[model samples]
Target chain A: MVRSGPYDLNVHCIPESGDTIEEVVAVARRLGYSGIAITNPDSMKQLPFSGNVEGFDILSGVEIRADNASKLHGIVGKYRNKVDIIAVSGGSESINRAAVENPGVDLLVNLNIAQDSGFNHVLAKEASENRVAISFDLGDLIHLKGGSRVQAVTNCRKNLLLIRKYNVPYVLTSNARSCFDMRAPRELAALAALFGMSGEEAMAGLTTIPHSIIARSRPPAGYISEGVQLVYNEADTGNIDEGDR
Target chain B: MKLLPPTLRARTRYLAFEVISQDPVRREDLIRELFSSAGSLLGDVGASECAIRLLAFEGSTGVIRCAHDRTDRTRAVLASISTVKGTRVIIHVLGISGTVRGATIKYLAGVDVFNPKDSHI
Candidate 1:
């Protein structure tokens, strides 16, 4: 948490994916990443890694996959307090809209699978207000080839335009399933450039946005909400901001 | 045939990279995949402009030479390469240098020194 890290916010590890969490963390550390979140899809049974790994931050996260909007809300509430971050797997139009509109969601992933940019002006505006980050999976650029690759790139370009227009927060993730699937921050930035994202913007997505998402999940002792918090004086009792409450 | 002057030649940058795979990868297989990756990603003309060449390969580590201005393109080319001859591989770039010796010494020789775990965040 001390580092303004080049963190990969969305990564899948053992039980859900091929590699174990230790293997994934070792590879990430070797590649110079300060931290990574192990976000296995919620539909799958997840084996929690409770103990901390020294010298590296492993933020526990859940990728909630819901068939409908109401189901999405229920899953978010169930896992909200259990994990450091919550991501919604986006595909259908309903799921994408639900994810963006929900304040509990920290990330909206896999929008590339949708027919078009499932994200649009309205969704972007909602996401901006909700502080939900749109995650662009660079793994699509690597794993997909031929026509699909072109389509994924095109979709990302369109999504990026909307994100920029609305000033929405965004993060870049490899969506890695294994140790080999993970990539360095620079390489991810290069892959990002193929879809018209500048290096600076990609770096911010990799470092700044993800860091902020993690920070937001864990506020200070007296924190209530954005811009306002509880205050306590030595001689007096603590007072919560009624407006924020 | 006459050699081109230094100023007329394309400035070269050496990229030091390590290959991570489940199986041992052959240098020949790596070379073939590198070119094909560059070709598929950047197309024929773009690949030719980058002037990519594998300078050296030993075990899992290697140094590649490309036009200095096309480092990002070259990086994309490397990143796009996920497999070689049915084996899944990830080419992780360690560092880049203006000279082959510098790349070898800085990245290949002293990899432990480059470990980010000990570095200030």
Candidate 2:
């Protein structure tokens, strides 16, 4: 049987949160997750960066939470090549726009304010064109209660519609800070259903999109850009001056 | 009291789950939390449609009976629950089966279902 193992694109460990990476990974494995990315902001120094923990994949991601557009752009530039994933913490309108417009940013995480959805058709178009994935952080649904939870669901539903209409890539994340906050992939899919996402779409978000994002960010050495790479032919390997032999 | 014929009876699914908590949680508190979470998320009428019931709970693992078609909805209810009796908890669904026995055998392995002491009733 072929199983598309699920990957959580957003998780916190160590310096960013109280729980250690090993503890979070152990709980995630018990829940049947294939891997998890530790997206701790400004704490990349503490991560192994490129290796998996005991065969389970561990991606070193950075979550950039800045106050304004300039600062957000500056941080994105610095971390663009340093991390496997770049997620912008969405809150204000300008920050949302800046995130989607920059191809360097992989995910615009949690796109909502108190009442505003913090997203629109323009941002959706930009996200689609830039290939920036929109993140539906289900952690809000887990952490928020009563009226706030209802509000978060409503906003997510609205964002889902826009994402579908624009054909933008969207990712599902528990946004877990600890083992208690983490959930199995199936449970995450169920919570996504509460916000109008179909089972298939949820699965793609959990597996396919995240995998593609990781692959896209980290290319083989001598990589230039998309559809462009440095290739060396055997004949071209020898210097022209020495070809006289 | 007459029992409904097998052909006319409602189809049900058994979901086996495990409770990972900060503190040891009793069966009663877990049941209470399940109902409230389902009720609040799915509403009263929706909860009734799912026909969710706690069939058996032993230690941290348990089996819940729900409508066959509502398994996903029941999963959402379980996922929505973040706490039980003020203690932080996560109820992760182990697996689902058409029959309670199948669920127990497949997901609740190592637990003696027939043992009275293991029954949290």
Candidate 3:
């Protein structure tokens, strides 16, 4: 069985319009979260993090939202190194295309909000290659109802089918602006079920997917690419300073 | 008229949920919103068949009853609500069980707001 207490990757925090980082942590723990990424604006990314808050993992993140593609490229290039998670807001078809095509974008949120999912077979293939995750912002489902909500969910269903078929990474987030906006993990799973995901699949979207994203974000140790880190015993490799001299 | 046979009666589900808001939520407003959301989402015929009933509301906690087949739709309606009486609010579903006793005793038993010692918070 998948473990509960899913992670939220798109919470607005600190110096912005959302809840303070401390308040978010306090309320998230009470709501039974395993970990959370406080994805504030890029300006807040430079602010230091306190390792872990109350034993819950708190990852610092940045979200880039510009109407034009060049600005998005510039912002992602600057903040990709600075934050643990990088999310690009998806609204226009162009923004969606730019976000998934760029290698630096860790997540693309709001893909299906304004129109379609902003991804066709070609775009879906590129996103899969780049490992850019697509997030279903629960706030959309919460705030929009009637026909608009129906349209959003229908679009999400279409997106989900393509995501699964093409092997694109995907996640679920509340995009919570306040402590009160967070939902219980169980509730989120139920909502995902309505969008054509199984309960286990929903749990994976909440838990495993985010966990793996964080894992991928970590820099490889020993300063080497895949399958190529050199090692030597301390006794054998000692006196490197003297050897250089 | 005699009551319908046990097997003929609708199998119901109890949904335990919590309301996170700055102000106390009145029962009338909660009822109105439930029907309003159900109606808007599922339309008149679907909402009419939902058979929603507000079982209880204690502070931030509540238990709602709906038909077995309509539980998923009812949960979506619960998720769709973001406000009550102009105050912004979020409704979190705790769990769903077949009986009221199961919903309250198993799910809502330790959900008391006053008891900080309760671990389920």
lDDT of 2 by residue, B22-118 (tens): 5678999998999988888889999999999999998888999999999999999999888899987788898999999999999899732221112
Q: Write one digit per residue (lDDT tens) for candidate 3, span B5-111.
A: 99999889999887867677898898898888777767888787878888999788889999998786787778767788787677777888999889888788777
- Chain B TM-scores per candidate, in order, are 0.87, 0.89, 0.88
Candidate 1 lDDT over residue span B62-97, tens digit each: 999999999998998999888889988888999999
The digit string of per-residue lDDT tens for model 2 on A1-245 reads 11258989889987777777777777787778877788887534648565565657777788988888988888999888777888988988899999999999999887654688789999999999999999998988877878888999999999999999999999999998877788899999999998889999999999999888887876656678778755654576855455554
Clashing pairs in 1: none
Candidate 3 CAPRI grade: acceptable
Measured against the true two-chain complex, the DockQ scores of the candidates, in the order shown, are 0.44, 0.37, 0.41
> Clash pairs of candidate 3?
none
Q: Flag the better candidate by TM-score, 2 or 3.
A: 2
lDDT score, residue A198, model 1? Answer: 95
Best by DockQ: 1
Better structure of 2 and 3 per lDDT = 2
User: Per-prediction TM-score, chain A only?
Assistant: 0.92, 0.90, 0.88
Q: What TM-score would every model get versus the actual structure?
A: 0.92, 0.91, 0.87
Superposed on all Cα atoms, model 2 deviates from the true structure by an RMSD in Å of 5.0
lDDT of 1 by residue, A1-245 (tens): 43666989899987777777777887788788988888998988876753346778888899988999889998999999888889999988889899988899999998888558678899999999999999999898898888888889999999999999999999999999877788899999998888789999999999988888988887656677778755555347556555874
Q: Which scores higher on DockQ, 1 or 2? A: 1
